[model samples]
Target: MPTIPSPRHAARRSLFQSGIGLRLALAALLSALVWLTIAWALAT
Candidate 1:
């Protein structure tokens, strides 16, 4: 007989992958926002 994986394990793995990607994207966005804000403040 063959063995099968559980649904809970699969869901957890997918969630972990998505969480890492989301964090990276959020960090990039935040840095860009801060840089732009600083440039605008200096220009004014």
Candidate 2:
């Protein structure tokens, strides 16, 4: 027998699928912040 998914799981899957661009932007933003912080530390 096949198991059915719960509502919470379905909602989470949809949210994750919808946030592809948001995830990428967030990743890029975080990467830039880390790079800037490292550069500042090295410059000081």
What are the Cα lDDT values of the candidates?
Answer: 0.92, 0.88
Clashes of each: 0, 0
lDDT of 2 by residue, 1-44 (tens): 23356777888888998798789999999999999999999999
lDDT at 31, model 1: 100
What's the TM-score of every candidate structure? 0.65, 0.59
The 10-residue segment with the lowest total lDDT in model 1:
1-10
lDDT, candidate 1, residue 35? 100
Kindly give the stretch of ten consecutive residues in candidate 2 with the minimal lDDT sum: 1-10
TM-score of candidate 1 relative to the true fold:
0.65
Candidate 1 wrong stretches, greater than 4 Å = 6-11
What alpha-carbon RMSD in Å does predicted model 2 have with respect to the real structure? 5.1
